[model samples]
Target chain A: MDSARDEPVLDVRGLRVEYRGDGRSVVGADDVSFSIGAGEVFGLAGESGCGKSTIANAVMRLLKPPAEITAGSIRFQGRDVLALDGRELRAFRWREIAMVFQSAMNSLNPVLTIGEQIGDIFTTHEKLKKRAARERAGELLELVGIDPGRLKAYPHQLSGGMRQRVVIAMAVALRPRLLIMDEPTTALDVVVQQEIMAQIRDLQRELGFSILFITHDMSLMVELSDRMGVMYGGRIVELANAKDLFAKPLHPYTEALMNAFPPLTGPRRELTGLFDAPRTADSCGFHVRCPDDRSDCSANIPDLREVAPGRWVAQSAQGAP
Target chain B: MTHPLLSVRGLTKDFQVGTVFSRRRVRAVDDVSFDLPAGRITALVGESGSGKSTIARCLARLEQPSAGQVLLDGEDVLRTERRRASQVYRRKVQMVFQDPFGSLNPVHRIEHFLARALVVHGHPATGEALRELMTTVGLTEDMLQSYPHELSGGQRQRVAIARALAVRPRLILADEPTSMLDVSVRVGVLNLMRRLREERDIAMLYITHDLGSARYLADTTMVMFAGELVEGGDALAVMDAPAHPYTRLLLSAVPDPERAGSYDPVERARLREAILNPTSCPYGDDGTCSRTEPVRHIVGEDDGQPHWVRCHLRAPASDIARRVLKATDDTEKAETTAA
Candidate 1:
């Protein structure tokens, strides 16, 4: 477990990404910064178009034209990730940091066998022979708790949960330092989702690899993440251990999001879903939706400052923290 | 008491797949039965291919049931051959599907599409009627003029809901209505559906894979597994303490952020079999428990709701099962509310 504790696996600093074309520009990510410790399951939580997924893409260097990393420094194992291109970028992808794209289960090639798809990773990355790659793929399938006999099964042959597990198996096949999973189980059922997450968690503990798990579901994040970063309107508004964030979210948007979904096993309460998105004129992006919005709160966008030893929050009202 | 708004008995649907020569019968919906009383929300919760959607389709008359009886106001809607009675039955039940984008016509504006449903369904197609329906679902005059593509996912879903309400249906069958929407907008739509129940006093059968949302909106929760009703009771109780082996597995499978509960290694190995194996006792693959067909065990009667688990493992012949069943309710209470 102490394999690499002193140094963070991923160190993203003051990152900025912009989507610009046709005389219009929108901030995809706004000077976001975070770090994932070795073997830590760090969850990034946010809604659609909130810039969480964009950050994942930027980290993987998969951003296309019209969506550029305006200004940012991404370091993996203290090596500059943004500086990599050509042969280095290819080396960095699976061998260093693998990713499970959003709805990756459905993204599987329908015609390809699950084994063939996973085996391709080994063949390309490690230059293993076809038969050897297939053997390694079967081993990976067994590692993810799937039957090795099902290696010949096509994408459509497996259930949604099975398909999702195959993707996870492939992502972890190379045993990368950081595995980025973007809403990995959003498509699966409740029962199967828990099972798949448990599989990932088990694999993480066994292999000791850090994960940047991304999803909008708060409850799911709480179950699996060691620490979490809450994203809103393209900025990481709050960062804390899962317990603190769930119990007491300091940022307004974080608090609002916690109240959005009703608890399954608790006493029922009313949720107003109060407030709207902050106006373009308002300096604070969440001012429009804040139930506790003040004139001073709308004056400036707050800086993400450490409030405690490990907790951080972006709130103008909190007075410099 | 008034009769149930809608009642389904031994509902079953089978789909034919594979080549014509080697055709296989996939039992999408097994012998499922449930009653939808007025103003009460009964949630049919299951994974994909659990037959919850098939039951909903049969109720909406979108698909024909292989064997079953859909009784509305004591009339067998499925058996009804008369056009007038069928029309009345169709008017009483309306469906809202999963994808709001795919459900709406891209070529038509919001107003025209909704207005057309009214005319085709024999409802008043006047401006006042359209305006009233739109207002009920929280839509305004401006949204009506825009195309479906112009509206957001939540707004488009609201439009679908408005169209369902256009016919003033007594029962609304919503099949995964909020799964495709964003997380923030999901609660808003669920809140809207909750408000509609009180406002319209309409019975709704919500089909969903997410139990958290099901617990939020449903008064009664019904757990479906392998195209069979494995458990049914009050939502709170069922979610809190699911009795059936399948229901317990389903509830514990929910990835609760607060509780990363222990996963059953043995169960995880047999996960796919639990969902898609078609036949086999969920408790254990044994001759006694694994019958030729699905069975519903009348576990008990408590409060206004009666808790029942459809598992051969808890058969009536077992003394312990009988004792648990009898402890829930006496014969008198069962007879009084047996309708």
Candidate 2:
């Protein structure tokens, strides 16, 4: 991981995405800020509707009308992502920053061959000839552990894991500096998921690309990420080194999220399931569900503060390092 | 010793794929057998196409097995009530489907769905009766009047469980009940299922790919692979010291915070390749896997609760056919004795 402290591959600051409808706007992502170092894996983890995907969409500039980026800037290698125009944004997407969605395997066109799909990325962005692009496609397929012979195979012909590999092959065709994978292997089988994660890790090491991996699986996020942010109720409540986050999570919500699923090997214990609660503006967003909720939590909102060198936590008090 | 609430023997299901001319039998569930004891949660853990769900469907009488004996409470339901399941059998065994959203009628209120099940099962459809059902699953009385869409995924699943309980079932086959739900709310449903087993003593067969949750909720865990029971034992013991190679592989693949950064791709690829060839043995290609059925070998036992594995590696290379026959006879004798 050749990370440079000065220049990050991607920098998202004060990002606030809102869904404006029926004369009211609901915050999908609120005041979120994070940066991915060069050749580093930065994870964003939260359950459904916690604005984790909203942040990913915002970074990719994929947010449409009704889903507005109300505040903040996204910078990729010091380039303002939000400022890119039609052609610049078009060139910026696959060439600079590529995204593999949650259901990216199913996103493939059934009619196109795997080779043809991978070739299309090169032909459109790199302006390579069809023959040259097709050759390059074969190399990309092999890079992701698929046989080059299967380049002629249709999307439906491939298995779920193979299809996802094809999607990943296409995403990295232009050698993007940043790859945003949103729950890339959630739908996959456990063993297949492990294989895919290993492949991704190998690809990142070889390609030297930063990954913005997003998922609700805390264990997976902790395993893959160098640094991660824990989101709750559209706000990033905690951010720290992955191992630190897992070993000793400061935020109550982060702790709850980790304990949500039972360990594969452990003594039987009660799992605390989180209740869905509306975020209170004047108080801590997670106070409703927080087991360590104090009476003062309802009076003051907690801000994400650097309690340690690399550990950042959002709590009113008693989160001292 | 008590008789199992449900005992499945040699259950198999085959589907015809391809064109009519090219039609051939594709075995989905092949000679799978298991027991669901009273008040115990038996988790059938497996990946996709592993036939865990098929067993659940076979038990619920939703999918008729091509071959098998579904013995319920010492009586064979398949033999007695051929073609369609009796209303009594239907009431005794209930199914909680995977998708809560798709399972419930979006057009109707939650109360209507619960009341319909109650009326069909000869239970009172009164408000208090409905409230009792809701309370059993830890839902409020007001939620009964709300539509399915009005409730969250977890709430809707509880309502589905409420509907299942409305029939006063003795056994529940929940097929990946929490797979479609969000992570934060999944445990609530699992805990509710646990409470049901504790309070109502309702036997359950939880079919899921998630090993972690299976270990958490189930008393006995059965690992299925390629339509075969590879391993079965006490939940915690099996998860802790997995005997079967396939079970070990599955456990290795699980994302554990304790085992982070220790992922070995080379080993995983080897195991995956070895296990994927469903026709061949994982340890070696001695033609034994393709030749004969692997006899169940008792690996460990705690107070007579045996941990068993169906693998050529574990089982001695003796007369497998005779051993399998002997094993079947022994199980039958034991079951008959219990009955």
Candidate 3:
């Protein structure tokens, strides 16, 4: 781990986001904070509407209207990203921090050739000539394992996996210090997902770039991340090293996620717990469905605290250690 | 033992791929057969273009099979008249799709979906009985008024399940039912299916590309490749022993935290290449696999039931040698094709 004093590649603190709805505000992210070191893969895992994606958008300064970062600080490479003006933010986007969205197939322009889409990145950031940009585009495609000669083909001409590679190629066009990928392989089949993940791992190793990988797949997160943060109901319920988190997940929600996925190698058993009724308004977010819920769970909202070395957990009705 | 609930024999489907005058035929689903035993889940596992979905579609009669028989309770439905087949088959087998959102109509309320199935299959004579079925699937009476878009993914899936149950079908064909759901919510849907199987004895054919879920849900698992069942038997045995090379490759590719640092990219590539190779084995003039084809070898006895595998490695020495030579030639062809 990098020292606390050293400048981190991406630092976020006291971050809170809200979605205004029907004269009331819905809490998307409440007091979330974390930092990523250089060449680190930070995983954010949660069920749908957990606000992990909202936090990523907040960091990127990409949140749409009505969904706003109500409070927080986002610093990229020691610069205040939230404080940047519109022109500065535009310049900072691809040059300093790039994004690879979930639907890479749709993210690329269908009409444009793969080379032109990638070339746009260099032209926009470096103000390169058309010929120079085309040359650089070929090099980027080659880096991602696509043949340079095939760059003239349109997006639809390539397979889903190849289009994802093209999106990755474009994201790293400027060699950004940080890359954020949202559910990058959720749409892919298992074999194709494995291939894409392997490519991502190799690129991270070679480029030494920091990544903020957001996905709901717990097993994938454990395999690829250095550190993992578990989110629930828009709160960071648990954060720890990948191995430690899987081995001994402190939060109730984290433990539930571990139990949900069947063991990859094991005897067959009829696994259950698929239909959990939603929690009542007064109860804790997990209380209604939690196997170990107590009466006190309905009344208190748990705060995340450091329970052990580099491990954090939410306070439960059973009380903190 | 009693006869299987659903028995398929020599199922085949072919598609015309190229231009009009010069036609090119693609054998999308070759001669394939399997059984869904009474009160048990069977998974048809494979990657894309492996004819897994085509098999499912044929079983559902969504696409007309070019040949072979789909026997529901010993009656050859494909041979039956089209109109009568729809009536009988619709009541016996219902399909749950991969996308929960797309399965339900966007404009209609949740109750309308369930009501339509119930009325079609002749159920819920009164409003009270209709609401009772809604509660049976864990949805409150209030949710009946909400549109499909208003519900969460998990809720929408439950509605889909409830719609299937409303028909009170003998068999349920769930095609990647929980693949689109959240990780936490996926278990909920799987558990619901298990409960239905136990309480109602609804035989399920759970088709999925995810082996982890297949291992969890299936009683008997069939591994499909290029429109053929390469390996099958008890789910536990197939997953644990995994006799075929393709089955082993699938198992190894699953993301496990325990084996994080042990994966080799080159090995994965080799396995992928092996799966993609066409003409790995020769079929006879009648389109049946040849006498030299890999035989189904019983690996071991698991809980008194025999575990089976279909691979050249498990076959006799002569077949193995033939397959080895064929594999070598295919590698050369693959290299030239890539070049």
Candidate 4:
């Protein structure tokens, strides 16, 4: 907990994003805010289309057309990331921060060898000699617990899990201070997912780098993250240390999400998630589905406020005490 | 047991891979046998390529089994040759796939989807029948006008389930039905299936890699590894005290906040390269395991029931070791009831 008080590696506030087209539009993120302290793992968790991935894209400045960051301030080492121009932004994109994408099958270059694909980053960015870049690629593979001898193997030759390990190795090739992993293990099976998560945590600990781990798997997030933020309908409903959030979820949406997963050890209780259709953006986003929602829940949007020493909940019924 | 509604006797399926001349046989479902008792959910739990899905396809006759028979009321499904009889067989058993997004026809309305299923099964495709199935799946009649793309993932899955029910299946094979759904909506689908089994008395074989859902929704849990039924018993017993090493591995991988710190990286990497060969035990095929294929050993049976396991390590015998194993199992049962 002491490390959270230190200077954050990435600070995000009032971040809002939208996907606009001809007649239809969506509020992808509304007033989402969080920070990742040095050497800390901050998990952003939600179900599909809850805008966790949208936040990751906003951080990387990788939003495609029609999806724009409407309002927000992202500070990396106290530098305004959104204010940076072409060259400064390009330099900051991968050097200061690295991203491991969600689907490893599409992330890797299919035609290139693992060594060539990884070495190209060093060759283009750092301007290292060809031989030196190849050596660095081997080191990256070794760090991820892969045999460096597989450097010459093509992506198709390797299995799905091995391809993801290569992607992680490439993401950490430059040894960036902060890394953003977007559902890194969502596509892998359970055993392979745990192995990849363990490898990523080991790399983070060894390098002393902060990470923003984003995923929809709630139990996985709690196990691997130091602190977590729960998102629902494009808004963060609660934020707290991982253990506290699991122990006592203050927000109604958070409670529902926790109960959605079947218990591995406890007595089996029937799960009750959202019963109705998702609500619109005008109201408290989860009001329609919340089991305990009141008429006041739809009156005004609840601002995310600190409710305890280190816990925060965005609900009309809870606040700082 | 009252006669099994659907009994699979030595079902096997093999696919030929590689070029025609150099073709090699890959046994997808190898000598698998299980019973779907009247209305119980028999969960076939395993990792990928463990032949769970293949068994589901075999039950529905989507793929011809290489050998063996699917018995319904002591008659073989394969031996029945007439087209009308086969149609009756299909009407008795229907399947629901994993991907709800891909399962429904994009261009068809919900009404058209369910109506077609009824018509194909020789029932009148009337508005009354369509509304009945929709209400059973907890969907409003207004959704009948909407396309498949307009519905949420959970709703679309319900539409698929409703169509399967339109045929009035005696047995439903749901192959990873909830895996593609979000964690929040997955439980709703499970609840619907559970209600179907209880109210309609429709037998279900749920094929999934996740054991957490199995224990919650299934009455019996059957563990499959490398296309072999490794262990099976009552759902509570299989989850609480998993006898086979592969079953334990699958249960341990489930993400539980309470069991967070028990995962070891070294152990995970070792289990990552799981069993591939059809004949060898996944843990390690010592000489006998590789040569003499093991058979099911009925371990414990109290009150005229059996806890069956297919493991070379532990065999049921009247000896000191068997007594020790039995003693620990009693303690496990006590702990389960206490919890």
Candidate 5:
């Protein structure tokens, strides 16, 4: 019941990530900016190579070599995440902001037992004793609806759904303010997906944790999130409340994404075109694919601008957002 | 009304799992039967381990059925010779897979895929005719030279559809074709399949777990539960007025953004529990409901647009059970109250 609107739990401004290799640099996240409040589910949606994941990885400061956070600031609870030292970053990582990777099944160590993996988090962060960590891991397992006794079992022993639950349990072990999940249920069945989603919703209500949910499934994003941001070619093109975004998608790319998903209700309509090839540096990312594409669309790159109250769209040359 | 193009009767598949010494027969697909009318799409929907995929594999001859009859033009394909069956079935039926990226070979150009099928099936005999087939599936002449990796998920699936069409197959079995693509691209693929079915007059077996997409493409839909067709009929009818408890539960669980603001956590939990335990219903194992399996029944005498449902509630004899159990009160009340 915590009001995320009071103050943002996590804030990012002019966030830019770039991949540098062989004396060349490729912009992965270009001036990405978004904020998540406590207990809010903020969705980051885009197609592959759209830089949504880059922003997520950058926030956690987990971007590996070749992928560098070139510019912008990430503030977790008003503290500059970029300013944290190695030891401070390690302590800040999962304790304050935990992440669940795309494939939750693969995220867990196959060789180790679920208990040991979760226990390691407590041992490293909380500096708890072996017995204390094991007990805490059991409690975490129980919290996620897994039998505490099953904590001794290996990841492969559990089904895809159960494995995901285990990953979620581990992620929420420290009761992090913000939990980043990148396509968590993409691998599971719909029935299991519904179950997992419900679990997350229930847990969020109980624990009062915010989420940065990332996926290509816009429908799922709309279902689970409080607010959503649409990404296209390394830019946050549009951001709005989940309901408003689905109701009136502002950006052309956002409109295309909404049109793309087959509605669960109503008459069926054919989607006419596929996403266009990524544009060159000089052109707008969505220029070729946009239904409203004009000569100016190809000539200039658009920037995110607030066209309506609490809704932002990538501004076009015609001054329409 | 035209006769069904493909009719499956008493289809069953049993897999031998565990050690050879103590082998156990797992009935992956039970005695399932359905009719696929020409130019109509029939969806085989179920969760994983529900034998939907097993049935699809059996239909495609990728996996041999332990018991069943696949009648193609009223000829039992299982009884035919291996070589003759392969040749006859290949031209009669073609398959499109879920993973568009995996279905096509990364090393091969998109043209090679369609060209090989065209040559083998004896369609598009001339080079000019082959290129035209490609154009029909919305692929340009330039894309023929592009490799699978170079193309997007939607484009790769289009190529798959094009390859299937090259054989001039009357039936297309698309096993979760759009599930792997981005949501934006998924509709485009589904729309393409729908267009192909309409233009070519091809019967399609569209398999998916996503009910939203199922409602979009299928003319008639089958809801599979624990390897059994628990409910099926007109797609809109089955979706809107889902008869089986499982089907209703599945439909209710679908995340509707409109209703997301007012979701009841308790009701969601109840539905989740019901879905997890498949044997909760009395009709699950009882022979009374299983004997006739309750075929399509006309609720009203108007147009005879009868909707089929496999639940015992639709059976006349189960009136006692319905009143005693009062299973559908909530659903029926909701509908009548809404009206």
Candidate 6:
């Protein structure tokens, strides 16, 4: 908690992103703002197309044509991340902040051996010779708990879990200070998912790196994150400690999202449905689906304000303490 | 105890892997058996490559089993149908695949899918019938006019389910139906399946890797591992006190926010290593689990609901140990001769 007061590892403020084509623009993220402290695991959660991934892409400068960061600032280690040019950005990316996308293991080149792929990172970034890079690649594989002997194996030869570990190993080879993992284990089975998450936690602890974890799995999000933000219609509606958000979610949408998970040990309850509507600039983004939305909710867009110490909620009138 | 709507016996499927010159047989589903009663949901839970989906495909007749009996209403359809499955058998058994994006034809509207399903099964594809099918799955009738791409993941899955229901299937085999959908939309689909069982008495075999959803929606649950049924019983009873070591490992691995900061990575690794390895049987000294098929052992029965486990730990009273020892001796002799 004390780290929250210090210089944050990553800070994003007033972030806005849009997908534009054919003379029309659709908001992908609206005024999103959050920060991760040193060694903190800050989780961003929303359904697909709700702008969680958009924000991640925006921060990584991975946005392409038709998708643009309309407004915002991303600061990494007190430096303007968006201001970094070609080489600076490339150097900043894997060396300072690394990103692991959904099904990253499947993205690995099938033609190359695990050692060759991992060695390429060192040879390209650090300008290390082939033999030296290969040695370091084996160590990275060992760090992620895969047998170093399998470094010579191709991606197709490794199991899905082992391939995922290889990706994680490659991502942290440079010991980046912050790691962005988006649904890192969604494609994995429960046992494999647990193993991967445990390995990630251990890696973070050993390397002292912050993580910007993104996923739609609420239970996994709560289990891993120190703080979390709930997104709806491309806007963050709630931000608080992960445990507090799970126990007492102030926003109605967050509460509904929590109830949607089928419990393993409880009486079965009827799950509610989430309504999807185009976002309106004048109203709160979640007003259409919010169960407790009032007239003011549609009349005025509520800003994300501090409703309690270290807790933030975006709602009209009733959000006030 | 009336007869179940669907009963599978000794289901087995094998796939040939490796190059043609060096082919190896991999048993995907081995001697699996289960029953799905009318108006009840039976969940088959397992990890990837654990034969859960293979079982579903066998039931749907999408794959020809190496050897098995698929009895629908006390009739063995495998023996009856020679070449392809009869249209009546296809109508009685329908399948819902995992990926909605892949399952539904993107070029065609939702109406085409449902109407064709009805017409192919000898049912009248009227506008009223289509509307009824849409409403039955809790989707609006207007959605039928839209293509699969226009709908959300959840909506597409519902459309897939609606198409399956349009034929009035006696047993629906859903293989990881909601796994691809978001967490918020997943429950709505599960609720619809539960409603279908209650309203239409449709027996369902829900195949999934998610233990939580199985416990939530299933009346009976069966856990599978490496193509074998490891544990099975009443859903609540099995989930509460899982009998097999594999089931217990799966349950412990499930993500629970309530159990934060209490993850024992070392213990998880040990359990996983012991269960997932193929060469060593964790509970036995002779590698019996790797070599021999597990025999069912009734561990407990409560209120006429029997809980059974198929593990070496539960088969101590049986003569399986002696038989495995004898088999191990013969295998040793054969290996020496081959060498």
Instruction: Please state the CAPRI-style docking class of candidate 1.
Output: medium
Per-residue lDDT for A31 in model 5?
89
Predictions' DockQ, in order:
0.56, 0.68, 0.58, 0.55, 0.51, 0.60
Instruction: Return the top candidate by DockQ.
Output: 2
User: In model 1, how large is the Cα lDDT of residue B306?
Assistant: 84
After TM-score superposition, the amount by which residue B62's alpha carbon in candidate 3 deviates from its true location, in angstroms, is 1.4
CAPRI verdict (incorrect, acceptable, medium, high) for model 4: medium
lDDT digits (tens) for residues A245-284 of candidate 6:
9989887878877767777887656666565555666765
Candidate 6 runs further than 4 Å off: A1-5, A21-23, A281-294, A316-321, B261-294, B312-339
Model 3 global lDDT (CA atoms, 0 to 1): 0.79
Q: Give the chain B TM-score achieved by candidate 3.
A: 0.84
Say which prediction, candidate 1 or candidate 6, comes out ahead on lDDT: 6
lDDT for model 1:
0.81
Question: How far in Å is the alpha carbon of B168 misplaced in model 3?
Answer: 2.1
Please give, for residues B160-257, the per-residue lDDT of candidate 6 as tens digits.
Answer: 99999999998899999998988768888998999999999998999988888898898899999878888999988888889897787778778888
Candidate 6, residue B158: how far the Cα is off, in Å = 1.5
lDDT for model 2: 0.85
Question: What tens-digit string does per-residue lDDT give for candidate 4 at A209-228?
Answer: 88999987789999989999
Error of 6 at B335 (Å): 30
**Alpha-carbon shift of residue B6 in model 6 (angstroms):** 1.4
Candidate structures ordered by DockQ, highest first: 2, 6, 3, 1, 4, 5
List residue ranges in candidate 4 displaced over 4 A: A1-5, A20-25, A109-116, A128-135, A148-156, A288-296, A316-321, B18-23, B81-85, B264-291, B301-305, B318-339
Total clashing pairs for each candidate: 3, 0, 4, 0, 0, 0
Alpha-carbon TM-score of each model against the true structure:
0.90, 0.90, 0.89, 0.88, 0.86, 0.90
